[model samples]
Target chain A: MLTIATGNKAVAAAVKEVRPEVIAAYPITPQTEIVEQIAEYVTSGELDSRYIPVESEHSAMAACIGASITGARTFTATSSHGLAYMHEMVNWAAGARLPIVMANVNRALGPGWNVWAEHTDSFQERDTGWLQVYVSTVQEAYDTALMAFRIAEHKDVLLPVMVNLDGFVLSHSMQSLETVTPGDFVPPLHLPHAIDVTNPAGYGTLTGPDEHFKFRWEIEQAMRKSVRVIADTERDFAERFGRQYGVAEEYRYEDADVVVIAMGTLGKEAEVAVDLLRNEGVKAGSLRVRWLRPFPELDLSGRDIVVIDRDYSFGFGGVLAHSLMAKSRIEPYSVIAGLGGQEVTFDDIAGFVRDRTPGSETWFGVKGNV
Target chain B: MTEIPKEEYILKCTSACAGCPSSLILRYVLKAAGPDTVLVVPACCTSVIQGIYPNTALNVPVYNVAFAAAAACASGMSEAFRKAGKKTSVIVYAGDGGTVDIGIQALSGAFERETDFLYICYDNEAYGNTGMQRSGSTPVGARTTTTPGGKTHAKKDIDAIVAAHNPSYLATACAAYPQDLFKKVGKALSLRGSKFIHVLAPCPPGWRFSSEMTVEMGKLAVKSGIWILYERESGKVTINGPSKAAMIKPVPLEDYLSGQGRFKGISQKAIDALKSQAEQRAKHLQKEAEGIC
Candidate 1:
């Protein structure tokens, strides 16, 4: 069925199709609506699941972890401080190899308490061993969520997945998406390590240094192998749903002298800027990074790259820019923009790409303000 | 009822100290919960007592979670079992540090939401796992590693705090009273919604007492009205066990305080104050129980 829905509703709609056995969540701005919609679905008998209204985000993730260890499909959502609060359990879920799916609304961390779109929140969790997928549209928000289950639960990749969408930009904006019924696309969940009462065994116990290092190495190996698993899952998803996606979504990058690299909604906006530059006799394109973890190594060779980061890592440069420079060995212009949900239009993005110097980091839009 | 079954779910050897009461508590708790139970333990003595990986003393499934997540984790396990249509009892076996202090928020949340599970706070009065340090459950004038001079405030009334939530079953027990502790555990297991069993588990080393005196200290604690025995079930409360007599004719608090080296400080004023406080608290609990009934 096709219908217009907000990004949060789209996530809820996808969760309905996924049919998780348990859903645990706490209300956080820009992420509350996702849980609220799921509650409505559960109440109306649209989804058969136990919705645990946990006290805090930490408990929410902890609850999901407990449920997931039992081989039950679990789901949760949080943003900014909520995600930060769940940091301990976040590592736990990944370490225990539970394929729990969470929707992390990208909001800026606060001293000023702003509930708006920024990548710093999810970006901070880049090394927590979770498979991170950044979505740009409401449809992709729904689609990525559905695909996350298959990717995370794959035998080769039994790791938790976090689907990132911008706080207000994608969470509150309305867009049309095609939905599916349960069991149509996503398969029934099957976890090999599920807790069985009749045949119970201990889980997540203390391990000595002799074996702890081996277990950590195993997680690293699984993360490395997840790349192929994710690709295969997305391919199968496209075959079933007729909608295609990749680790990195390319926009007119072929035969271009310049490419603007970005994530989330800004990645979508950069496509407009790319087209604008192309029409004005500038050979420009955009490369929208879809997933940051298993972080796909794209062939950014022979092009002047311009990286637009919505987050900055203190002492280091922008997260995306650093990752790009490390992987591609390219000194791209790293421009920080749209922080704390600050407005950065296509014109601003085009201006960033137009007057870019290689290897230089620019605090775009903050030049005059600061 | 039927002798409460003599089967021991936990094995003989544990990582617990020589006279740690946790082994006894675990044995009784598991006996009541049965083989089809899942235990969620945080960073407490039970976490270490369960033994190292691939070699646990427990017969049932154990999920050793983070310090502040035992209740929430058990909540998830119960819900998972319910959804999977499996007959499983999820229990949180946490220490006083995880229960009364760091883990209170999670416990309160679980109780408020009425998540179906059993939470047992084995109050050893201090953070025994991380070395003997003062915790919320540590009584006033008792010297701990952190509270070298002695804790300034009285023990936090966790029983009263949890009772405010009005759980399906709530009780306070001690290992010294095996039959009563087992009975409360059995009763809690029979209920459906959130249930709590707070056991005053004494730590010989942490309490600065001889290893052989753990059970005796537990007994003295109740006899002196320091640890009151009570149960709040289905909106009605009742005073239970040895403490019931102490409510009418209070025992000398000196008997309880003098036995432990933690209270070795020579302060007659503090001793009198503690005794008076225990007497007043017991009287208030008895009055509250009468009103509830």
Candidate 2:
């Protein structure tokens, strides 16, 4: 059924379909609406789940961890400092292979304390073994929420997954979405119960110094398998709901010399900018990265790419650009712009692409700001 | 129903130090926690006694996390079980040095999140794991590796800090009282959300006491009001044990202090000051329990 919904509401409605047994969350700006909607669903009897009202972001993850261990599909949502507060647990969740799903409304980490869109929040947790997927639009938010369960619960890849949506840009932005019923959505993806007290299994048990390396290696292997599972799940979603997203979502990239790669809301803006550039006879295209952690290496090879990094990595210029440079040797220039709620205009993006030089780190819309 | 023999119920293990209060308290904790619990142990003496490769005294699953990551690891384990649909209890078994110092941030994070788990800090005053080093929980005027003559800082008020988080259950116990320790462990296991128990475990090596004097030292510490038995439920303090008889004068601080070589360098004035401080803290706790403070 097609319904008009905000990204947060769409995520909440889609998660309701999963019928998560427990929902524990403490509200932070932008992400608050997701939990608030879920609370309403619980109160209205639309969803039957245990909602744990936590005091802070740390406890929210803690409560989810507790409820999840006791045979429940737990869910939580947070943004910015809340995500930072959950920094330790992120490593824990991934190492334990919890298959827990979270919605991170990507916002900038504070000191100056701004509440707005940025990728730093989720990007910072990239190596924490979470299958991080960035949603470019409201429909993708709903679609990714459904797909997250399948990818996370995959037997070969039993790790937590985070659906990253731009704080106010996508979280508060409304659009049409096609929602599925819980009964129809869950059965095919649901695997046999992994946790049973009767037939006990040891999880997150102590590893001696000798066996610790092997345990982490096993986690890495499982995460590697997620790339295939992510692709498969995206195919399954497309078959079921006629919408697709995962890894890299390419737009007009065929026969293009200059490709702009980005994630989240800026990718949406980049799509518009790409078309504008093309009309002006500038052979430009865009690739929106839906999955950031399993850094879509296959898509980045042999391409003159321009990465729009929304957040800085402090001493280092751009986190995404640095990651790309570290991974496969790609001749890509990073445009460090749109930090702490700063606007990324089309002119700024166009100016960067127009002056694009291969193998150099340049800041777009950063000149004269400092 | 027929009754089993009392002799059969008692453990026949002979490995622990003579009259070790922690050895007895640990037995009760394991009994109450059962085989389904996963324990996270940090760098501490208990971690040493639990032993190096292939000689674990514990029957259930145990993880020897880093000094500062026990709470974080336990939180992770709890989440893992939740995802798998298992009901296993996640317990963090840390020492005073680990809990009161290195692991404080992780502990605070876990408590703030109200993670459903039991965090037990076996407080043996100083760090017994590293040749009796002074920890945050070490009492003022007590001698140790850092405090050669006497400690300058007071024992960190951990119970108050934990209670401030509004945990579901918080209590203090001693290995001398096996039944009390057992009941508190059982109670903590039954409750949901974050629960903390601070057990005063006397170290024969660190306390400069005889191996056989462990339980007696514990009892003396409590009876003299050096360590108070208190519990907090939903952020309200409640004193559990009865106050010592007023007719019987409180023992001199030296009586308790003399047992430990840690306090051997304390001057008469310092001992008197410690005695008064212990009494005042106990009275304050008692008043809080009585709903007057």
Candidate 3:
């Protein structure tokens, strides 16, 4: 069915298509619409799923963990503070290897108390054994959410997957999305370690030092193997739905001299900036790294790269930029922009690309830093 | 009266401390819940006593969760079972520290939402799993590792807090009284809405008593009018036999406090305070039972 909906609604629509057996969630701004839509579906008898209107985000994730362990496909949604509050269970969900899917509307954390688009929230959870994919448009959000279940529940990749969309930017903004009745696309989940009522068992028991590392290694092994699972899932999704996605969405980079890289909505804007730079006769391309975890290699080789980060790591610089430097051993012009839903237009992004200085960092809005 | 089931969900040879009644409470709880049950345990002694992986001491499924999350986890597990058209009992077996302290919010949330599950908090009055640290459930004038000089505050009234939710079934049980504990679990499972059974489990090592005095300690608590055992089912409160008898002619409070090492250096003032509080609590329960509140 083709219709127009906000990014949040698109996620809920995809979830309805996947038809999770259980959904436990608490409302948070920019992400509240997702859960509200899901609740409406559950209430209207359009969806046959257990919807738990939990009091807090911690319970939301914990409930999902409990349901997921029962061999039931489960989902939940939250943003910023809610994500931060549920940080502990977020790690446990992965450690327990429960393939629970979650939609996180990217929003900045508070001290200054801003509830707006930023990547810092999910970035803080980068080390947690969760596969993360940031979507740029409502269509992509719906598509990735559908594929998330298939990828996370794959036998080779029994790990939770986080679908990220910018708070307010993509989450509340309406866009055209084509929803599909994902029958047979996402198969019935079979959690090998799911609790059985007939047979008494113990899960999440204490593991001495001797065997603890082995479980961690198993998670890593599954994560490393998920690269293949992700590729295959996305390929299958493209074949069935006629919508193609990749680890990184690259545009006009075949013979460009300079390429701009970003994520979420900024990644989409970066494409416009690339076109702007191209009109000015600048040989620039755009590369939006979609999947943050199981991070895609940009293949920048011999070209000057400009990386924009909507999140920063205070002392370590941009997470994406620094991680790329460590992995690819390349110096990219690192620019921190669009934090706290701060306005950064295509002109500003194009300007960042035009004045690309390798090995240097710039804070876009800072008076002295830029 | 239903005879106690002979089959045990908790097998012998676990790592529970000697004279620990928390495990005993679980033994009865599982027997009542039976094989069609899933025990959601947070970071408590039960988590350890359930044995390490590949060698669980339990015959029923146990989902050991993080501290302060047992109730919330059970809410999900129960919903999943019910939605699947299965009547698998979801029981949260947590300790005092995980209940009255760290896990209180989740507990309140689950009960208020009317999650169909039985929550049991085996109160040992201290953080026994963490080497006897002081907990909110620890009584006044009792010492824990964290309260070296004896605690200054009275025990938090978790029963009162839980009553505010007005669950379908609510009861207080002692490990010394397994029959009562067993019956409460059976009743709670028979109903549909949220149910809670708070068991005052005596810990010999944590409380500084001889291993053999675990049941005796629990008896003294109820006999002395300190820890009242009762059931509040659908708004009617019935003080149990031991507490009802104590109300008419209670034993001395010192009989309950004397053997516990946690109260070795109790001041005269603290002792009087403890006695007064216990008397006031008993009066309130007695009046409420007689429809006098």
Candidate 4:
């Protein structure tokens, strides 16, 4: 049934439906509401699970990892500094192939210390071997949380997954969401039977110099397999929930000259800008990246694209822009703007697309230098 | 009292340093912890000491994680086992550098979560694997590669830091006192929540001591009050051994310093300062113990 709810609540309800055995959480802004609601469910006996109230984001993830390796469906949530705090565990979870799911409310990391929407938190952990998916709407956030578990636990892709939603913009903002129950959630595809202690297999065992390289190589191979598993899971999700979203979602790209690729809640605004540009007779479209990691290179072929990056990479202009250019052929005007929680107004995006000329790469919506 | 089975648990055929205090401590810990334990190790000297694949000295399953990820990795493994309905103890063994320096953030996180596991940090003071570099736990007036004559900073108060986290149990031990170290490990294993035990394992190579002098140096360190043994529970401190004043005769700081090359260049003034600091610290610990009593 479709219900009006905030992104945080939608994620909480989705996780509750998944019926994870353990929910380890530390209260941080934006991400707190998800855990708070889950805690209430657990306390009220609505969600039958152990809810560990951790002292910090790092510990929250640590507890989740412990629970996960024990063959339990484990989860945790965090944002910005909390994500940074759990940075080390992010790699551990992936390397261990624990299949733990996390919901990250995207927030700006600070010198100014603002708790607002940005992509830095999730983007910074790009290399942590997690299958990262950014959601633009409350419904997508709700759906992605469910699909994440399926994709992560797949035998061919035993890796952790992060479902990131923009803080305040999506996490706090209320929208309509369709909920799925646990009964309807499992039993679709084959998955490894819950870690069997009876068989007594060891996990994350010590790898000395002899086996260390092979162990890391196996993790990398699993990540590569995740690209295919992501597609398969999305297909299964569409069949189950009547919604289709996978690595990338294209809107009116056929016969279009310029495409603006983005992820998270910013994609929603970019869609609006693309529609306005189309109405104005500009050859522009939007590519909403559902899967941020594994880079989705298959979608970037033969296109002149403008990436609207919401986070800066310090020495590099935009992390996503740099990543995209590194893999695919770059068209003119791959601009970076809307950083540090700066508003990416429709006019800001429309102006950039309108001013774009063939072979002119530009960073739009940014003040001063390109 | 049941005597510890001192049937030489460590294999003489193994490939650890000739007089590695950590190697001896590990053997004792494993024996006390028994065969049912799972160990999580990070990138440290112990990882190398455990030897290459198919040549490990340990009988328990050991997980070698990233340098800064032992706590998190162990937590995940523990959780997985619990979810699968397994009843097994999870233990993480880290060195001073891994536990007190780069891995501290992860360690702090694990403690905060109250994961049901035992975390043991073998404090040898410096980064032994990387050739005796100074770590956060390196003591003041100790010469390491980074701290040539003496470390400018004092060793971090890790016990206090851990106690502040309100863990279920926290204790300090030294390889010199096998009974105390074994008892603490056994106690930590019985606790359900996060438990921390810091063992002062003297490094013969890093401390610039002769192979045979490792245990002697550890004994002198405690006798001089430079390495105190205490436990904290419910925010209360309890000293395990005799109080500084109650001791028959406190060993001179020079006796402890003389065995280690790291402290060979210490001036008389510096030694006197160290002695006073050790005495003051022991007194404070005694007071805390008294308050608990």
**Top model by DockQ, which number?**
3
Predicted candidate 2 versus true structure: per-residue lDDT over A1-370, tens digit per residue: 8889999999999888898877878899989999999999999999987676665676567556545544467788999999998787678767766778999998988788889999888888888888888998888899899888877878888788999999888899889887875455444334343334344333444348997788689888988898899888878777877877657788888867788877888887888788889999988888887788777784567667898898877777787777777886787878877777678866667777887777777665455532
Q: How much is the lDDT of residue A187 in candidate 1? A: 69
Best candidate, TM-score-wise? 3
Q: After superposition, how far is residue A355 of candidate 3 from its true place, in Å?
A: 1.1
lDDT of 3 by residue, A84-117 (tens): 9999999999999999999999999998999999
Higher-scoring candidate on TM-score, 1 or 4: 1
The alpha-carbon deviation from the true structure for residue A81 of candidate 3, after best TM-score superposition, in angstroms, is 0.8
Per-model chain A TM = 0.98, 0.94, 0.99, 0.93
Model 2 Cα shift for residue B74 (angstroms) = 8.3
Native contacts, share recovered per candidate: 0.66, 0.10, 0.76, 0.39
TM-score of each: 0.97, 0.84, 0.99, 0.87
Residues B155-233 of candidate 4: C-alpha lDDT, one tens digit per residue: 8878878887899999998888888888888888887889999999898889999999878888888887888888888
Best by lDDT: 3
Q: Which residue ranges in model 3 land beyond 4 Å of their true spot?
A: none
Worst 10 residues of 1 chain A by lDDT: A180-189
DockQ of 4: 0.32
For each candidate, the alpha-carbon lDDT, in order, equals 0.89, 0.77, 0.92, 0.79
C-alpha positional error of residue A54 in candidate 1 after TM-score superposition, expressed in Å: 1.2
Error (Å) of candidate 3 at residue B276 is 1.7
As a whole number from 0 to 100, the lDDT of residue B215 in candidate 3 is: 96
lDDT of 2 by residue, B6-116 (tens): 322113552455665556677778777776776767777656555444455556556665567677556655755655566788888888988999778778877887778
